[model samples]
Target chain A: MKKLIMIFSLGILFLLSACAGENSASGNSSQSTGNKNSEAGTKDGKQVVTFWHSMGGAGQETLNSIVEDFNNSQDKVQVNAEYQGTYDESLTKFNAVAGTDSAPTMIQTFEIGTMSMINSGNIIPIQEFVDKDGYDMSGLEGNITNYYSLDGKFYSMPFNSSTPVMYYNKDAFKKAGLDPEKAPETFEEVEEASKAIVKSNPNMKGFALQAYGWLWEQLLANQGALLLNNDNGRTDTPTKIGWTEKEGKSIFEWVKRMVDDGTFANYGTNGDNMVAGFLAGDVAMFLQSSASARDVIDNAPFEVGIAFLPYPEDQERQGVVIGGASLWMIDGKPKEESKAAWEFMKYLQTPEVQAKWHVGTGYFAVNPAAYEEDVVKEAWAEKPQLQVTVQQLQSTKSSYATQGALMDMLPQGRKIMETALETVYNGGEVDQAYKTAVQQFNDAIEQANKARKK
Target chain B: MSMNPTLETNETYMYQFERVKKSARMKSFIKGMLFLFPSILLFSVFVFYPMFKTIYLSFYLTDAKGSTTVFVGLENYLNMFTNPIFLQSIKNTFLFVFYTVPPTVLISLFLAILANENLRGIGLFRTIYSSTIGISVAAASVFWLYLFNPTMGLLNKFLEAFGGEPVGWLTDPAWALLSVSVTTIWMNIGFTFLILLGGLQSIDRSLYESAEVEGSGYFYKLRRITIPMLSPTLFFVITVSMINSFQTFGQIDILTQGGPANETSLIVYSIYREAFVNYQFGSASAQAVVLFILILVMTVIQFKLGERRVHYQ
Candidate 1:
């Protein structure tokens, strides 16, 4: 019995020591990455800049190649780009390690995360770097730059920007006796098109809208409607949702009309499934990010038509908000490491790199000069649909609605709207769903403010 | 008074004897504690500390970093009860448990009984029956996700082939929770089956021999002997399966993501969304505390009521 006790104690000691070792090893690595009060540590005489991004698939491949090019361009900095799941997941992780040594030198956060990243108190605004470096901000695209800057101060460097565009099967339009070149431009038009498509082919649905909060916001913006109050939370903090009852309810009612007609396909909160549905000829048209242009065009058996986001007939098209991520420099990093990351960020803004990014993924070139590049010219010549996404952004009327809302609660608010949209798709009364969503959204914003007061 | 000297000496002797016995008992207690020290230390760091922290955080409003900002007292708890989403989540969780547990237990028991029979190639059949236990939750969920896809899923294809309208397996509000529950039940059956089969094999062969010699029919013997003998395992499997159903997360995440208007958002998934996604750690902690109490009460009730029927040979 005594011998058995000794062995058991020894075994436990071994496990405890192993756990301690693992903890210390992780602690050491984080410290080495974010060295404070000391010169930023170098790997092989090159400053290491850890960049956490949330780009997957083709975007990831393009980003990795760009990083490789940046690394090979000079020997002074070795930028390590890490793919950190989705925007939601990576943001959660960043929140957990925001001020800690484990935090990256820089992080790419989604457009909606801009307000939270600024409020996080763990980042250095891009305005400082721009001023210090004398970088020409005017060279970037106006619509893209407008989304990133607040009060003429850039908080983050816009990267991989996109906008919502309507993708439709051109072949289905021809078969339905509708003009193949002209896509639906208004909510009523889309409904009519859906009816025509369904009338042409009973197996195919006329339209599909994935129950997504981003799409809902884009649809509202396309109608020149704001998402949150207080000038879309730009001039002041938002207290409630910005859109009027009519503006908000129009989207629901339009979807309800489609549902009532049995021409709407609902893919609840699953974008991939919606895309698959489109590819399988189950749905003729859908609204999705322009970033999916290359994938959709390449995979579709039919000619895919990319068009501007549809709006209500009464409201003029207000265009779309930049719908991708931006890079923010983390605080508490050494000046040299930040400068190195800044250099890489500038490299990403160059016309050559942006052109590659634009052609490689359906995302817009933050630098408009990239549109002048031969690569972009050749790609557009081959597939004219890609240019429609860029044209929409260029034509956007800059307003508080198109600039998009700023609030940490936007993500939560999105979830509320998504649930509301799902209710409408599932045949719930539009007024009831809209009212419940607005109430819950206001409560979330109020709760957020109350939480922040202390 | 002088004649009581012997009695007084006897009292002092008894006091010394009691003191020695007390010290000896204390030594044994210390030794036992020493033997239990490892597990106690591990549990204190991992389980007990976190549990107490969760309870402590439940009363305070926390910032994005999860640090306490304001003392809200019972506000978080009160808000949860009034929150329709939370209430729906609780109802859905109970519904999911009902949908999954009995089916899992019954089907696994039926499979276990069939696989327990002495027959040729029984090992191969047992392997096939228990194969899913080797598959991880993530892999199994992804497999089911493809099968449940609304557009190009095998299920929809089969329905279309039969000239039936395609059902939105994971898209419709009424069907999403049931679809997730079906995936969970399929994933759970293998582990439950293996455990039940092990229990079936451990039963004394002579008991079955006597039942057969008495000319008791198959169904009769199974009712009188097999079920009574397997009662202990059945009780254990039911309790565990119930708890597992209550805590189901992975399949729901992969399959439904608590979508179609939050129909499949179970308690744990709701708590996750509240804390990690919404960053409402205070309310999440309150929900966690409620879930803890719920699971504790359920387990206590099971122990009290179930143990009476468990025949431990």
Candidate 2:
């Protein structure tokens, strides 16, 4: 018994010491990594700026190359770009590290997270930095900048911007005896073409849209409708949702009719599934983000056609809001780090870098000057479909509706809207679904306002 | 030296005895403490600390930055109880438990009985039945996602072969919860099968032989002997399966993301969404505390019920 006790005690001591060793080892490793950030700039006499972004795949590679170029441009500053999961995840992680010394010098946040970040009080407004340095903002696209600005003050640098567009399978259109060259420009034309496609091919769905709130918001924007009151929450924080008004009801009715007529496949809220459905020939037409053009062209078994987002025939198209992310400098970082991050941000806006980013990743270059670059011009000549997104943005009018809604609870509001879509698709009454969704949105807004007050 | 020899020897002997006893006791006490120290330290750090912190955080409201802002004092719990989504999540969790536990227990027991028999190539069948145990929740869920895809899925194709229309297994709100439950059951069968198989092997063959000698049929023998003898294992499996069903998250996340109007949103998934997605750590901790209490109540009830029926050798 004594021997057993001794053996047991020895085993426990070994385990305890092993755990201690592991804890200390991990602590040392993390400390070493942290030290490297501080030592990197001092070692080479260059200031180091850490950038946390959510771009992946080709976009990440493009960002890395841009950073490399900036680092080589001068020996004064070195920028390190790190890929941090999806937009929401990156924002969440940024929030987790906000007001902490270990926070990254810069973070890339999506357009939807704009309001939250603005209210976070942890960001150094780009307008401030631009004014302080007298940086030229005249070359940036107005439509993209308008969405990120409040009363003409931009908070973040619009890095990669994208708008929603119509993607049609040209092969499917040909098989259905519809015009392959002409894409639907209005909702009525889309429905007519869908009917013809479905009639020709009984096995295929004529159209499918991701049951996402962003698409609904885009539709409302195209119809010149506000998503929320208080000047789409730009001048003042919104206290109520404006989605249950006339335009919102009209868009909802249109979607309901499409679903009822078997012209639209409700692909839930997953964008990838909707894209896959279209690529697999299960659907003839798909409405998705312009950023998806690269993947669609690469994966589709047939020619893919891209066009502007469809609008209601009666209302003039107001264009779609940008859907990608932007870069923001975190406040409270060292002055040199912030300056280095700002320098890298300015370098990213250069025509050469922007054109490379635009051609390599299918996202719209925020800099209008990027279109003048030979690389962008050549790419546009090769694939004219890429020009449609630029034309849409260029033609857009800067209005309250077009500026997009700025609400801290927009993410939760989107979920509520998606729930309403699901309800309506499942044979529920459209009016009731919309009413319930609006009520939920109002409740969420109230809660958000209360929390913000606290 | 001046004392009597007998008195001196007795005194010395008593003193030596007491000294040895005290030292041995002290040594053993220290050894016992040393043996328990690691587990105690780990449990305190990982389990107890988090539990206490959750309870403590439940009374406060956290800001968007995850920093505690104000003490609300049961307001979080009250809000959760009144929220429709939270109530629905509780219902969905119970429904999942109901859909999965009995079927898992019965199917695993059936497989165990089939595999327990001495027959040609029974080992292969046993291995086949237990292979799912090796598959992680994530890998199994991804495979099930393909199976549950509404279009271009193997499940729909199979249905189409039978002249039935394709069903939206994961997308349809009516079928989403059940679809997730099916995945959970499939993932659980392997572990449950192994446990029941152990129970089956441990049941003495003499009982079955005696029953057979008495002209009892297979069903009668199973009911009279095998079931009573395996009650302890059955009890264990049911309790574990119930707890596992309540805590279902991975399959729901991979298969449906608690969607189609939050039909498959189980309690744990709701907690995760509230905390991580919405950054409502206070409300999430409150929900977590409720879930902990619910599971504790359920475990106690199971124990109480099992005490009545679990037979021991």
RMSD of each: 4.4, 6.3
lDDT of 1 by residue, B197-250 (tens): 998998999998988898999999888888888987787778777777877777
- How big is the positional error of residue B202 in model 1, measured in Å on the Cα after superposition? 0.9
DockQ of every model listed? 0.40, 0.23
Each prediction's whole-model lDDT (CA): 0.88, 0.82
TM-score of 1: 0.95
Model 1 stretches astray by more than 4 angstroms = A1-40, B1-7
Compose the digit string of candidate 1's lDDT tens values, residues A7-116: 54334333432332232243354445444312345888898898989999889999999999999999999988887778987788788778876788899999999988
TM-score of each: 0.95, 0.88
The local lDDT score (0 to 100) that residue B287 gets in candidate 1 is 93
Candidate 2 residue pairs in clash (backbone atoms < 3 Å): none
Clash pairs, model 1 backbone: none
